[model samples]
Target: MSANTTSFKHVSYLWDEAEAAKLAGDEVALLIYRSNLLGADLRLTNYGGGNTSCKAMAKDPLTGKEVEIMWIKGSGGDIGTLKKSGLAALYVDRLRALRNIYRGIEHEDEMVELFNHCIYDLNSKAPSIDTPLHGFLPFKHIDHLHPDAAIAIAAAKDGEKITQELFGGTIGWVPWQKPGFDLGLQLKECLDKNPGIRGIMLGSHGLFTWGDTAYESYINTLEVIERCADYLEQNYGKKGPVFGGQKVQSLIKADRLSKAAEIAPILRGFCSSERSMVGHFTDDDRVLEFINSNDLDRLAPMGTSCPDHFLRTKISPLVLDLAKDEDLSDVKAVKEKLAPAFDAYRKMYTDYYNTCKHDNSPAIRDANPVIIIYPGVGMFSFSKDKQTARVAAEFYTNAINVMKGAEAVSEYTSLPRQEAFNIEYWLLEEAKLQRMPKPKALSGRVALITGSAGGIGKAIARKFVEEGACVILNDMNAERLAEAAEEFKKDFGKDAYATAELDVTNQPQIEVAMKAAALSFGGVDIIVNNAGLSISKSIEDHSQKDWDLLYDVLVKGQFLVTQAATAVMKKQGMGGDIINIVSKNALVSGPNNAGYGSAKAAQLHLSRLNAAELGADGIRVNVVNPDAVISDSNIWAGGWAEGRAKAYGITVDELPAYYAKRTLLNKIILPADIANACFALTGGLLSKSTGNMINVDGGVAMAFAR
Candidate 1:
């Protein structure tokens, strides 16, 4: 079913009965359909945080007779983007048979292995640990979700009493229990005792609803969440300004972004002790309201109550409380404070681990935080990539909603320390982490390529993305920029890159572009100064306009872009890479090349100067000089190619062959070859080398760096 046009007051309903009818006879397909509809709304569930299931009668391969089968979301799968292959199929009887072994809670990890024997489809995905929660239940369809509204009720101090008052006898309450065989049994007992109940509220957990049919299950889940939201909404504002009223005032929208930009990199650096991380910043109203409130210090430390929220956000966020009179725009002020704060956070986490670790717990993971809360500024979250970082921030937002709702009608309560520790260090969760694929070499880095609409610039952007870095594709041509953006989005993903349309010579435009980059994927870690044009002319023939044009697009443009990017990089307190795409002409003297060659020489020297100036900040500056890369290069366009051929006494079409013949390797250079050198300098092979020039012209004796 597609998204709905109808606006919702409390919780949105997306289930389309007409659409469900199309898959009426196919129970598994119907289950997938229902799961998608429920997952479509964040009011119901967050990404990869919940599961759904359905039981159907299927023909057994051995007996040639119908037997009951269960189809459920598999391990490490998301319901919103789920496909048929993503479901795990199991024989209901085999799953039920595991009860014969009847191991206690001490053997919780062992029950996961027995599920392999219950496979109805030999090639089905491995079953999730939550399988028994649905299999042992008597319902045909079940949904286990962590909706913000439901979690607010489940996480309240008087949650049991609230559940009884809000849901009456229709929904029962289950005390805090780590999900496993024991929890499933408890749920079964609850159902057995409360025969007509629709579902039960899981304390400090989420909501679980069931129905005999897929449609019934979907509606029941929606109705229950909406009822909670309606009740919370009715009582929410009756208690005066939320969160004990605001204690601190927020910065204007513009200053908020600038302050956030100043804060994001330092926080990101703190989190990167184990490995580099990408950052995401949010300055929305909801975050501002929570962080600026009087209860922020109290509520934030209490932590997120939902397991899904806690896992992504960590046990507690690192909170930065600004002095009332201190300036938020001072990078030096913030950095000095963050250094101590980071140290304290790491020590605190390590202490927590040492205090609560099981003998067999996974060795201490990274002690850095995944979320940070800064009052009057904004929130910053970090992870291995932009998407994960963004989701981490979003999950924190969901936590904010829950905290607000719970505080309105009842006191907010987080999971007890022991309970939160048990879930965080759970062996099953450790196994899931181990299963993730290795990250690419350039993973978590963000690159911005100027003149990336086509040719060498576009090729460099593509290479960075292929190596797992997010890129911002910038060019002056709107049409080409759109086309490049479309291709990158299609080939990689929507989050792989963002596009900025601006001329490199424009300082205002350059500033705007860098801001867009910060907003798109946190901050820029790499810059490729590649926007330029070539003018082939002799001393007597060269015009003032020609010299100015070459300098404006090549020399001055690089300076402007670098100047703007440096502010963000230094503020981030994270060292970065700057690659200048100069030319062979920079070091060699050739006929009819005075204008182009001189500008390139200036660019080369400018890069060396930047390398020396920014070295204290750990920012590396380098140059990639390419020659005769004619395949997709715009430099060999207009009259430049023909004029160069005429000067060499060859036809315009022979430019490629002539340039290759002069090279030491006798090879025609391509865009990918230039891309390789850029990657090598920034990808850590020659990471220590800076202010160095690497020629990508195959080989040119005269142009070689000495």
Candidate 2:
């Protein structure tokens, strides 16, 4: 089945009567439940791209009496995971009073402030911009959404006639207007003129449905969307020759683009800004089908599928031509092709901004394309981090589907360019952008940590993320890596990090991981060679296999991953840091630890060599030598702790105390201590230091530098 056909179905009312009965008196609880049901379905709305509201009776703050109030989704909150705090409560009468002063409100900024002033409680969050439209309607519940199927119908040239035909005058149609007090008033007027309508469709915008209860409004939304989906399927489901049987061309498959991995980094580097690292997403089959179509060049640049998407995707995407036979891996070819294309794209963006922006408009956003359409390879989405890029990709992916459905029925149309500009440069959106928190120290940087499932490596990964760096976790254990990624997501957002299951000693896998890091998070800013295994054996008893195993992981693996990462750093023309998590054994060896000490010593020397050779490229190589960090450490697992405890003539539980008392400072070393040293070296705190080994052993005399 086609992508559109697979998702087409009758409306499924997800309301559970038992659950609703439990929340009978709690309108907010019922509202959240129904909102989640609508938001969870991508067919209904994109992430955080819809609003819902319900009118209920609540005690007034000023007067000790109950009054009618409206609880609506707040700005910047996702409906799928919305909570009580995500909905801002407003006094219904106070919000409705804005219509009296609506004629006097001249600026959008004033309108936004007036809406904020209508909050029922002083501590409540700022209500959504569309709250006025929700409050003005006479219904007790309302939902406004940009469903793909509904969008396809609303964006068509004959959208009004289609709405009338499908709903039989049950749905009112309003012409496109910039959303604010004026548009809300227009919607109120439209409903008054057309009595008994179940919903309203904003031209080139989306759908709005209302009823006496949350379930009624939600089902109305679902039924309207299903009707649009059914209309498209019934009228345009058949395949036929259009344009006088010119033999329409098919798009190239993604698998045919062998060099997508290599080209991803180049495109990322080309699109990056001074303050932002450009994360990338290589297209899947659906995207490849859309970008490779015969009508791509014409349809792609016309406009976005929805006006709200213009802020994320821009008015149009940047189009590039990649020949099938070109070697994308070649540095010279990538530079020659991408450099000029990026320059032209920037120029076009500047021209558009200059032509559309008014004196009162906020400053133009950065002149960079959010979406990139490549003819041969596929398409890509660029953003400061992975999550934002994913959201843009999701919207554009849906856009392709909507465009296809619209084209199948009638010509696909978008709001005029000026209308798009009005929303894109609106003061309210600009305020939202300005409200973002300041960038952290390592913002827009990518760090890769080997053996990141536990211990020092994991600690380092967490530190990087805390400082606003996108971390890529690598471990041989896939299960541990997945768990670590999920744990990190709880603190940092899901897009702040990525994971790869990798055996550092595998050369092929090392190369793939390097490319994956670059593709997933633009390019590498830091590389931590922290993956190693410890073995204890006498010199006479140590086998060649044991020695080789240590060397392959501790020495050889570091060399391979570093070499690959350095190449990408060079391509990006950005300096980087290479930190090796060596052991104190490198400086002072213990008995029966020959293999481990020898490999670590070799890695320490290799780091100095890399530092000497790569200094000209601004890449700093440093070493963090830590010793006896047993807490939450994986290296001490599998009888190693017991063996060490036996050697020290102490119980396993007291082994930590024994080591702590041995140091001059009588302090125990922890993984976080080593991580802090690593962070200090790489985060420009010790910018002038390189090829230097910093100790985290709480005063190890034997391991001290001369």
Candidate 3:
């Protein structure tokens, strides 16, 4: 099924008015309620990426004296899912004291500790990263969100103009600033300038609204977003292309298992951690064309839904259209082609940052896109968690809709590149970077890998960390799963990953893993279906059990993982990448491995099918077919190779030579080789390619079944 590209509708959240009213009189509860309502309205703050606060008088537990305290959203709690425990009660005096101290730390290692100390309530979970800002606000109730609608208008050419038009003189507009102290200062200045203003508009960022009551605060936010949405509709006229029930592509069976194994460790990291991740799946060419558009020169830098969204969806989408148009329809080949464009885009981004630094010193986000949208296809957003993805998707779709509208007029003109850079590298934006250290490549991004505890799956997880991705490592072996996690840390560093002990073949486990990954990483962006089990017996000797085992891990597991990941990706709206590790066996028939070969063949076709169906969502699903390269360490351990060599009437030494001579490269293929292919498929370089399969095996085309 195609993703939901339909325009948004106003539907009330599962908000309990009576419950909210119950918190009205109590200052602390009122603040929590306001935050809850605010988050419910804007997908951006859903699980609580944002925070809320109220400064009120409360008796100190230590002393009889009453003092002002701020009740703020607790750390790591989704504002939409908040409870009393989700709030931190920090002393206003202490908070104010910290405000007076200049933030001395700049680098992340120094900042995370300082941020940790900034918390006011130890009993409460970690405080919101915006605690300092919350402390600065004078209002009794403050609500902040990476609102989808507001961001849509804010990240555009005339965002300020639109804000001015929508709220008239009542709203305060601040250019993007980093969130903590810098944003707090900016917010304070705005509040100081307009004491009666109901809300604040962050340029290329989010929306902050305050009121005397929770309902009032929520209503104001609702009014603002609605106004912006209405303005967009009137200006742009909403309607996207309708897919006429075209059959979308999916991954093949054998490729699926191999990919599952490869992506498992990363998936485990995300699922086991509190963070969540989501991924998109598709390999449609038209969709890729949209993503890799050179038109970015005329448009603004597309980002996650808002500033906070960066934590979920990184900074840019990996354009994937090149796969469809390339001569070799393979993940690796297309990635090579896309490198120049991606580098160009990065260089351009750096130039823009330089221009916008206005100050001699400036902070810049890494040259990675959090949301990836393939034109004429779809888009995907990655986050450490699901809430982040949901918010990103909402804003991204709306922004794209508006951009489409602008295109209809003349050409879509977003904020100037420099202006986008200003927001992207704002101090408030910078403050968020201070709180948590980024993992390797896919750090904030989510990954799902099957059979991650062993062999190639484990290797892929390690590689992703080196590049900065939070992974959900999955495997059926509980003992191996623990061992892999330890091995990853030992190889990479302390706290290098997360893991889940799951049988990828079971749809239930796959679904659970998907949700868990989202919660762990905030959202998923990459899926590597790299789990597989081989049967050595020939076709006549192959039992149904063997067929089922091979098919379950190789084909069905991929489908289940992709299916779940795609749901989260579509909601996130930034698009996603799915990589399938298939075998050259799909291309060449082999003895004693017919069941495995048949499964691999089906998997190859399936990858293409997924690409077609999910293309509209900007998902890129690709396959990597590797020739025989002895992946199963267990096989070597069990003397299976020696036994097979005897059966083939060849010495064991000759077997290795036999496989090597068959390939053009004449090189030994390692797990790292396949890992490289998977990397190219999901990273920003191959942003435009999808549904293509590249052969990694030595020149053996003996199984050319496609």
Best by lDDT: 1
- Tell me the whole-model lDDT of each prediction, alpha carbons only: 0.88, 0.81, 0.62
Give one digit per residue, the lDDT tens place, for model 2 in 567-684: 8887776678999999888998677788889888999999999999999988999999998899878778876677667656688999888888988899999999988998898776
lDDT of 1: 0.88
lDDT of 1 by residue, 1-706 (tens): 2234353566777777689889989989989998888888888989888899999999999999999999999998889887789999999999988888977999988999889999999888889988988988889999999899998989999888999888778898889888887788888888888889998999978999999999888878888888888888998779887998998898888877876655566676678778878888898799999999999988998888898898888899998756534564677777787788889999999998999999999998889988888788888888899888888998999999999989988999998887898999999999989999989989989899899879999999999999999999988989989999999989998878988887999998897788777767778899999989998888999999999999999999999999988887887767899999999999999999999999999999999999999999999999999998887778888988888988999998888889899999999999999899999988888878999999999799999777
Residue pairs whose backbone atoms clash in candidate 2: none
User: What are the per-model numbers of colliding residue pairs?
Assistant: 0, 0, 153
lDDT string for model 3 (114-197, tens) is: 545544556776665577666777777777776555666666666677667677768888886555556676788888997778
Model 2: lowest-lDDT 10 consecutive positions? 241-250
Question: TM-scores, in order shown?
Answer: 0.95, 0.93, 0.50
TM-score of model 2 vs. true structure = 0.93
